[model samples]
Target chain A: MTTFQELRLDGVRRRFGGKDALTGLSLTIRRGEFIALLGPSGCGKSTALNCLAGLLPLTDGSIWQDGSRLDTLPPERRGFGMVFQSYALFPHLSVRKNISFGLQMRRLPRDEVRRRTDEAIKLVRLEEHARKLPGQLSGGQQQRVAIARAVVLEPSLVLMDEPLSNLDAKLRLEMRTEIRRLHQSLGLTTVYVTHDQEEALSLADRLVVLRDGRVEQIGTPEELHNRPANAHVADFMGYRNLLPMKVKAVHGDTVALDGSGLTLEGTPVGPVAPGDDVVAGIRPEDLRAGPHGVPVTVEVVEYQGRELAIEARTAEGVALFLRATERPSPGDRITVTADPSRVLVFP
Target chain B: MTATLPDRDTSSTRVARRHRLAERGIDRQLLLLAPALICVLALFVYPFAYGIGLSFQPAEGGVFGAYRAFFTDAYQRDTIATTLGLALPAAILNVAASVPIAYRMRGRFRGKRVLTTILVVPITLGTVLTAEGLLNYLGPTGWFNRTLMTIGLTDEPVRLTNNYWGVFFSLVITGFPFAFLLILSYLSGIDPTLDRAAATLGAGWWQRFHRITLPLLAPGLATTFCLTFVLAFSVFPSAVLVGDPAGTTRVISIAAYHAAYEVYDYPLGSAIAVIMGLVELAVVAVVLGLRSLLYTGSTGGKG
Candidate 1:
């Protein structure tokens, strides 16, 4: 039996012909840790996941699973259970058969295989639909079967590649909770890949944000969300208000910025100096309607269930979007402000 | 009643009547099938009906004379078994060889189109050309024997041509490309991720193929088998040129041809042709029946 300890990816690189899909990814995953590889499409998150599963050979570098070199092994030898975005359940097989596939592949005893598959089906709450084929089941049920298939193998590491992407929005949310519960209860070292930032933030113990086939940043959800490494990351992490400004003054931790419609005091992230051209980023929620701020005419207002998302233009026609508890209509004049700590200045 | 009704209602009824006429106009879309329907009627149905009529009017004895003669004569009856022996093995071999080959070529790769084009060259060569090529190539003093001698595997030239094997080989060469193309398309329809998923689940390559790929591909294989069998069962040119036609390789089609043209027994030939067709249909039906027994589930995408 393989003990749960650490899976080390040391300089994982994958090159397709002349083009590099995954340049080099090196990360250590502790046992029971949920790691989310967050990136936009074509950022090599899937490629990295495939490499970890040994589905794709690395152009360079090595992987170690609990001190044993893993890169040289075939995918079957890697013993990783993966849930695909398309589910990829053998359409010819029934739900029970699909769930029991991995166990049967391992040549497990008949009774044990049956018991484990039954338990997994129950765990996914798909016992009623066990006899039906994947095509006969709804999208949610198929997803549950896929999850059951992967986890039934009882592999220390589970690799999920945008598993919820094919589900409807409501089903996606439901399955997200189901996945999180599965991860916590089973204590699986899960490496999930997704383009959705919110999904990565919600489920991951640590998040690795990638861009252009490279890791932009890797930290806990709060760390990456609060202290983004650069402007690209800040923008991706829902810092929607990225306004250009000239740095008026720099003191200790705060830098003052002067813009046509937005005069803001922001925390310095990287190097900043007086008179330097910088971009100040503020999240929609961070910007609120208050006094002693830039007067802007609201252009669009969106109702976001409990709050209003207001898009406005400044006196000089710079666009600003802010979220407020108070209702504001379009074409209304309002002043918005940002706390110094909430504002991030990127040069 | 019409006079009491409004003018609007009367005009609307007239329009509705015209719409109903259009809808009932012999299903306008079926007119598009005119060329295909005509071809089937003229080429297949008329010829088949004429053969059936000719078969019933026996040249001697009674109306069932030709069929009775075929069943009573051991020589004629043996042709059915001979044709089955030749066609069944040839079709089975063709499908068996192509399945693995097509599976390997299913995925996209460099020069795939070129490879497929080269592989299908034997298909266009036809039975006549292929038989002649095999005669020259597999003859006693041919390069194949020369190579065998040079390799020192055998001192005597191996007898490959001028026998049942010659015709079998010809059928394989000619029919393999057709089977390969069909099976390749079927293999391509199956999702590659299914195999990958199986692999990650601890299945080895052979296990994945045995358990997953083969089961999903069974129906397609059955179809390829039926088509290949039809191609092989009607063995005329190859049997004459390559096989020992009068003795060991005397297939049913040769019996039909011999009876019709050589002996001037058209009714007997018609009866033989009918029997041949029935036998082929029976084989195809059996294969289809076996296919039904397999898991013929949908291999759709994104599920």
Candidate 2:
């Protein structure tokens, strides 16, 4: 097997009509790496994937693989496989023919096409449905066929656009592990576009957080979860409590907060100065109901089988939500504390 | 109070009987449909049965008199071959030509609505008007022939009307729109993402069309071809107006007309009509059977 090199998207920009969908987007995808493009809808994650796949022409910039230019090529010439959001399986073709379609297009020998198609069907665990049309199969089965159809080609890069978005929760979970396993077994470089943070977090080796067609932060899942660069990134990463507090004093890495009606200390993750307005973020799991903490009035208590989500309002009218193992009634007064290290302050 | 209770019970029983009658209203529903049934029987079934009866009436031969005469006579027997010769080619050409045009016009662009409107103009003209228009447009001194001569494409004016080409062109003019509309609808019903998926799977444009689009559109195409053939087979007005009705384009309808009106032989004419119907039925059945073999229902994402 030949060792694949790297694919680099260099300062890619895309415009639709007069509106910019992507602006100066750049990323490097190494061989056998699983990179997840995570963002909200219309954040240009899909646009970026389309640009790399040559499905859409870039307004400026280029994509390079190894030493050759790929952006100038057409989608079919790019030789990259894409799994669309709709699965987009040929409804009229049997699963075997669907999987063998690319090979047939390449005019491969019939025996080899049959051999690879059989392997792909077994790989996707769809041997029983090898003769079934896509319409006759279940949604999960159809999606498996779609996966086999793309991977059978054995292209260098596999691009998926919200492939699991249409599935039910249970199926999505099943396919998530299936995708991860396939990527590992095939050793194929993959670029996945999804709006689901949890999916990206669990599946991706590296996460690229995008907002408004721009990269907000790019890091490993743990790095993004623990230390998001700004308030927006933190909010997207499940940080529920974002309090706008004025910095009263600073001592090394610790900063004192004011106007939040509490003498709380938070660690400054980004540059901060005295008297500067900073947003202090804390994850719901990090907040604990303890004795030495700020008093809050519990506004809502939502039961979750193993834990409860407690929504509370601070003395200064700042709303926050925290998770608790013990159930608390709404309108009850409680003190919630967060560790200084867990709290992130961004200016 | 006791007297009122007995009376109320009787009235309730009557209401229950009425409800029962309502539930078993099959006869009533048939009665309601009597007018449509009467219209079909009188206007369609009665005439059809009467024509069959007339065809079986004994003439010079016996019970199978008219049919025997038609098969024995060269002119009448040749009409079937001639009509089919013209209709089949015209229908096939119309459907085959419409596919690429419909495929190109499936997506929206500037002047799409106007183009569609223009395409359907021939259908709106009807057979009579289309024949009249073709007579002038395709005549010896008509603009079509004159233009060819003026452009030095030909030394003399070409003969276009009152021949096989004239009737063929008229059938195409009328049938193309019908086939085009049907093909366009089938093309539009397909999800565009299917083609995009094929493209990503290394299929070029022609491959995508041949594998995905053509297979999916098979059923619609067969149906459109049958309809257009039927429309072309009964080409009486064009055959008489812009065709050599006594020679090349003496189609089945013209023969049936001459038998009934000119020769005053209604039995022979009715016999010809029955044969025409049987031939159409055979073609339609064959086409529909082929459609079943080719059609795999729809295969794409639900729109």
Per-prediction DockQ: 0.84, 0.65
Q: List model 1 lDDT by residue over A197-291, tens digit each.
A: 99999999999988888888999999989999888888889999888899999888998889866678999888988999998888999999987
Tens digits of per-residue lDDT for model 1 on B171-289?
A: 99999999999999899889999999999999999999989999999999999999999999998999999999999899999999999999999999999999999999999999999
Interface RMSD of each: 0.9, 1.2
Fraction of the reference Cα-Cα interface contacts (below 8 Å) that each candidate reproduces: 0.92, 0.78
Candidate 1 colliding pairs: none
lDDT at position A238, candidate 1 = 94
lDDT agreement with native, every candidate: 0.91, 0.90
TM-score of 1: 0.96
Off by over 4 Å in 1: B1-26, B149-156, B301-303
Give candidate 2's error at residue B46 in angstroms: 4.1
Q: Clash number for model 1?
A: 0
